[model samples]
Target: MVDTTLEGLSAVGDTTTGFDHPGLLYHDRDDYLGGARAFARAAVAAGGPVLVAVPGSNLAALRDALSDLGDAVHYADMAVAGRNPGRIIPGVLLAFAAAHPGRRVSIIGEPVWPGRTAMEYPACGQHEALINAVFAGRDAAILCPYDAALLDQDRIDDVWRTHPWMIGADGRRPSPWFAGAFAAADRFNRPLPPVPSAAATLPYVVIAELSRVRAFTAGQARSAGLTVDQTEDLIVAVNELAENTIRHTPAGGTVSFWTEPGHLVCQVDDAGHLVNPLAGRIPPAVTSEGGRGLLLVNQLCDLVRIHTRPTGTTIRMHMTLTP
Candidate 1:
């Protein structure tokens, strides 16, 4: 088994060829700005491409702080670009890295923030852990920032487990509690909470019933106050997942929908087992024949969570009622 406890490590700036995943535990705005600016500057000095993909407000602050770099540093609003944590790896990080081949890449990716909802936190944690696996041999460093003052203790602890290195006010060190990439991802691949008792559910037996699935999703989205565009997006996402069930599993599956405080949730359960953990996160090539369904769902919905085992697999898609 891979070593869960990462012992004997140096500071964050040790300069390694392999992937470096560091967690920046910043206590306040000033601390956040300082750490972020320093990382960006170091990347520029190293002559590699730099990408700062953080929440909108943080993106604005980094832009102002790094004004002298001009277009040398790329900026993306994580709130919009990475709204669905599942998309951050393929859509944002890897996409930027792919743009500049043969060059080491530096990225400041802040996926977790105070405003992240409980329903979204699991996916965020999983995303952070999976980054280590996705970029294992690549020459890249990703600095993930967590708000120490605003976020809860559980979230802070998760940061320690997901990242191989932790950076605090004092300095950086290897995380004693760091779990290997797959272990951490499996830890976050927990069974989703039960949907409300009132959630609408429908069963599908074959491809012929896909239209019914879309109609059901549309009805639930509209009833939950989703706008026309939002409803259409949810319908498409649900249809894609349901079709996967029909195409892959012999037993078919069930579709369910419900509403939380600020979001509408849709779920599909099938007997198929998804062996590939990175199934939907990586973008396929242009000439590829298949494998774009789940990626499309991740882009269409606000959040996507998957729980798969030998017995079955359950995929849930969340869409905010307001946006």
Candidate 2:
């Protein structure tokens, strides 16, 4: 007999069924834990692999509850792997999903935990919405757990707009408030804040100009009081995105660098629309080719944002000059 907790584990059923890439969870401890286990238990029963990507404490919580069965589910501390919501797709979800092709996998991801800062929150919100665009179809069920008690009403409310499924202890239901999730994410896509007036700017329109771009960025970063480590990171990030612009756009783009109180900011803009929000966030696999630039930038920088539309794409990378 099926466990009652397994009820509504997958609102869209198995891999073949059409379902949203993300299912939003507005839950307290009990409901969250229950839903997590239910999905795992159900996946195991169906002979599918299960990955539980949450904070360390929650991993322990689910592991203790599942016991030997818990050993069956792979675990990663989402707090670390998903520190940047942009990274969760390639680092966690897609990595696990790619491991077992032609079969469905279950993933429990908690990217919007309570401790996430306000500056980071918008990207998290956009991350949740972009999940649909990244994994619109295929064989994976990604369950995003949100703590209702910890999150504000608006954050909770956004879940409805981003995810197609609403999971609770009682059962799963279609999100009545589900709007165009991608569009909603776009709404949260605020422009990259202005670079300080005192900062430096470098403009380029060709591949041949990349060296100059890097030299200027490195020099400006140092002038802004960045340490050697911070300066190096900014240089690498600026170089990569500048390279991406050359490869992706015909008209090339411009690179701008500046510094704030405790942070350094560099932005690259080009006439290219990056529809995939998860682009640089995901790590490339052994078999993968050429998408590691943005991922590298995310690792080197403290925070990153990409604003893309029909007109063009602007990728902003932020680094904390101090440890």
Candidate 3:
């Protein structure tokens, strides 16, 4: 049976079939601990696996609060493990859920936090919204917390649109602004800004040109102060994207490179369109022969954004340069 504490937060439909996801609006550290502790404790009492994936400071605090539970509760530092919001679903959430089959999983996931850059916020919002569709019909309750005091008003408002229910100091209630899963995903799928005029661009029309693509990527990444390992990873990621274009599309794509604040950005534009919304978000089965290119790219980069339509598709990847 689902814990009453989590179930009670449901103001709409039954949560038994479709998972329960609630946005916890917390103003301070005390408010965050209170709500998160209650939710986790109840799940532990129900004898289900619990995962607490939040930022570093919160992870430390939650670890102390649930110290008695020990290994009963699994903890991950979201700041590192979920640096790329695109990896949270496949690498963090689903991986934990799949570990213990036939059991309900409870998670405290805080993806959006203070200090998140403007470029990263959209991916975080879409990740929160897509959780509904990805975990549909699963036995899990994910409580996402938002720092109302730290995050801006716009982000707090997005919390409502992404989550169906919300928990506040008063109590739990339905979010009137909640937009359904797919609609919310589409809302965040805004087109990426054009590459800067100064960005270096190269076009590859054949698979044989892959070597040149890697060389070009390495030169640009190194020039932007990326470390040796960072340059190699960026090269691999760009190679995978360019190779995909040659293999899938009749016309190959163009690759561009530029630098942002502390990041080196690489973009690939092709005449092909990506139809699968969950393409890189889900891990491929062991028996699968292919489909690991984008997943590998997500793992290698600090941030990734994709814009796809009937006209064409553009994929942008960001790698952080060493200090």
Once superposed on the true structure, which residue ranges of model 3 sit more than 4 Å away at CA?
Answer: 1-18
- Across 1-323, the per-residue lDDT of candidate 2 in tens digits comes to 11233345554224334444445454456766666666667777777777888887888898777666745688888877877677777667777888888777877778888888776778888878877777776667777878877788888888888888775544557778767656868767777666667656788888789899989987888777888887888888888888888888888888877766666778888898887756775566769879898888877777787778889988877776665
Give each model's clash number. 0, 0, 0
> What TM-score does candidate 2 get on C-alpha atoms?
0.80
RMSD of 2: 4.0
TM-score of each: 0.91, 0.80, 0.93
lDDT of 3 by residue, 5-88 (tens): 545434211324349999888887777877777777777777888899999889999999889887889999999999999999
lDDT winner, 1 or 3: 3
How does candidate 2 score on lDDT? 0.74
Give the 10-residue window scoring lowest on summed lDDT in candidate 2. Answer: 1-10
Q: TM-score: which is higher, 1 or 2?
A: 1
Model 1: lowest-lDDT 10 consecutive positions? 1-10
**Which structure is stronger by TM-score: 2 or 3?**
3
Would you list the C-alpha lDDT of every candidate in the order shown?
Answer: 0.86, 0.74, 0.86
